[model samples]
Target: MARTLVIDAHPDATSLCAALVDRYAAGAREAGAEVEVIVLRDLAFDVHLRRGLRADQPLEPDLVRAQGALIAADHVVVVAPVWWGSVPALLKGFLDRTLERGWAYRYRSNGLPQGLLAGRSARVIVTTDSPGWWLRGLMGDSAVRQLTRSTLRFCGLKPVRATRIGVVHGSTPERRESWLRKVSDLGRSDARRTPDAGKAMPAPREIASDAAV
Candidate 1:
């Protein structure tokens, strides 16, 4: 069975992000994948790296466990709200501190970075207060770059999918329900695809069974 790691960066479990998180997790779990959650609010770790990784901030025990889940899961699901046109500081800080340079990526023979977290797949579920597509164009997709192109993909995670839930500030109950269904469907699709999600992964890549976590 596929293992999924879900990271929820929201401060409140009753928030819209959490609702989507719950729905997606249910759908994914119902579709036959094992799921775990890394709720950042409940973790005991410094959000800021202090002076960056050169100082080598130690991962808190909870964050370490979170990293372990990240290492073991065949698929990752990240949920958060849009703050300042990007993911909230809670989630970004988790990425900043937990996704250390040497742990997730390393320089190769050609001075190019090779991602070690290959064969893993990921999806980001973002909720925003603006209308759909407003942030992507206005903010120039910095969030997408950080989550999809830069971080997750940089570590060799393939088949990444991202869905944005927008207009949340004034969204009606029906709109929210519709968005919930979409995220749930995404979870199901991802769960269904996990058996072959790593078909395109590089050979000899580390899988959940091979991880020390």
Candidate 2:
């Protein structure tokens, strides 16, 4: 059976981003896949990596469980908002604290780090007030790219897929519901099976919101 873990990084419990995560989890469960959700806001762990590669910081209980979930998951879905052109501090901190050395990666003979977590796939869902096209053309998609590349890939998760929903500042309730449906569909599709490693990484898809409404 497929095992999927959904990480919700929104601080507000009632935010639309959290709702999206719920819908995704529901769909995955419907598909008979085991689903787990990690809400960062609810966790009591410190959101800062004070030591930075020193591996001196001790992970909290919540972070320890999260790390185990990540290792056991066949697929990982990260849901977060893009703030100031990057991920929120809460999610970034969770990554820094949990993805520790000797756990996620270790240096190889060439002095380059080799990833320890392999054979899993990841999907990144990001919400933003700015349009995805603008981020791609002007801002270079910094947040999503960084997570998928420098972070996830660095830890050995391959073929990472990303979905960007944006211009949310003025979206109508109906439009927001439609976005949720799209996320549910994504969840269902992933639940059916693990990602095929042989397939090429598709270009990031965009969902334009009624932000100007």
Q: In model 2, what is the error at residue 168, expressed in angstroms?
A: 0.6
Worst 10 residues of 1 by lDDT: 204-213
Q: Write the per-residue lDDT of candidate 1 for residues 129-150, one digit (tens) a residue.
A: 8766677777776676678888
lDDT of 2 by residue, 1-213 (tens): 778899999999998889989999998888778899999999878888887876477667677678778877888999999888899898988988888887888889899989877888889999989986788889999999989998998998877999988678999988899999999998998888774234322332232233411
Candidate 2 residue runs with Cα over 4 Å from true position: 195-213
| Global local distance difference test of model 1 | 0.81
lDDT of 2: 0.84
Clashing pairs in 2: none
> If scored against the real structure, what TM-score would every candidate get?
0.88, 0.89
Model 2 lDDT, residue 82, Cα: 89
How close to the true structure is residue 114 of candidate 1, measured as C-alpha lDDT?
A: 91
